[model samples]
Target: MTTAATTETSAITETAALQDRLDFYWSGRAAEYHAHQVSGARAAIDRELWASVFATALDGCGREGSGALDILDVGTGSGYLASLLADAGHRVTGVDHSPGMVSAAQAAHPDLRVLIGDAHAPGILASSLDAVVNRYVLWTLPDPVAAARAWRTLLRPGGTVVAVDATWFPHGVDPAMKVPSADGEDAFVRTYDPATLGALPLGTAASMEDFAEVFLVAGFTDVIVKPLPQVAELDLRFGVAPGHESRPHFVVTARCP
Candidate 1:
């Protein structure tokens, strides 16, 4: 084979290997991650706060209250969002890459439909969903732009895509992004190696516009990024986990058109 072809094959092999490593890391971290997420969303009011955010976004497109919207929750770790949306009377299907996470979500909410699927390459039909939603997903994606563009093909015309995430790693995948788990381990530091960190453009993203422009560039229309004030308010009342204080999240809304 030529030099270029050999290089291409090696790159593909490396990427596949990295994804495998990521899957394992997330799987092993599922127990700790679920506990953390569930704790924050333990209160009914906090769950409702997030529900309202989804409601308003769905309402903007005249989807909410019109009927039961079909929503796809990508990277549905522990099924927290799936349960919330299901309780709100929407038809929700959750997709995660790790079997561990899929199991946690299913075990927590037996009735919910949670499948093992990649966040970037979901095995879903085209233009068959009313919305594609994710929480804390974009920051680590190797190709977020490609993922956003793929999501556009999954939503029906006028459907909305909502992403809830914050700049957790303002300093990229360095020691600064490390936070000890309940057991005093930082799984993120282990999972995000040099290649992983290099691939994630949003890891060091410093502004909200950085998140907003992604959807805009992906061919989505009416992209808007706004502070999740409700989340901040709840954080103040409930208290956040260590190292998360003063770190506010934002919601990005982009219309599939």
Candidate 2:
């Protein structure tokens, strides 16, 4: 089992691979994207932006213990994060919509449970989870409010939901960097305006107040929003455009009460 600080270079590289796995439309480009991200230049983008977001979300899950803590990683592409958590002694279940991603994760960590399923489905039931962690998924969902509500239903009273996602596009990169639709219809990407990104479905908007409010409405309490300080190394390397050079996404932790 490896701690955050002790994960090997290969494992870190593996984590980078998983990040590219999130653009569900890019399944064919996985290898290329993975390679583009492994250089030192890209390392900072990951550390400052992505890894920090996961760390913040996991923080709300509390500390590791001898007894196993139950956790679900929604959109658990390649299960690297869940694998790391499990290494630290948590009992983790990872679920993803992509079969390829699920297969990769399960193959990578045979000891952990990886399932092929949609986060929006009833496959996960009410009050059955201790915590739910999602990253880079909110903006992709067509119905963000319903998605949040579903997450709330899956958590037990006092359980935590930790989610992180970017609100802005790459500075010079247009949405075209991503195919408008991957599945023959304009159904894959849910385009959100800046206003929409900050609102209930996509995010709590800019205010920590609004962020907390959504969780409260979803029946959560003690919600906290933490703004991760930018890491220059991360930005220069993995950032798609200049906008990401200055701004990083927010990670929120809210507990179901």
Best candidate, lDDT-wise? 1
Candidate 2 lDDT by residue in tens digits, 38-92: 4456543463455545554655453331245677888777676677667667778
Models 1 onward score TM values of 0.89, 0.64
Q: What is the C-alpha RMSD of each candidate to the true structure, in Å?
A: 2.6, 12.9
- State which candidate has the highest TM-score: 1
Return the clash pairs for model 1, or none. Answer: none
Q: Cα lDDT of model 2 overall?
A: 0.58
Model 2 scores worst on lDDT over the 10 consecutive residues at 180-189
Q: For candidate 1, what is the total of clashing residue pairs?
A: 0
lDDT (10s digit) by residue, model 1, range 1-257:
47998999988798778778777777777777777766754467867778888888777553453778899999998898888889988899999988888998999899999999877789899988998998888887777898899899999899999999987767655555555443245666767766577767887788888999999999999999999877777778878764455567899999988
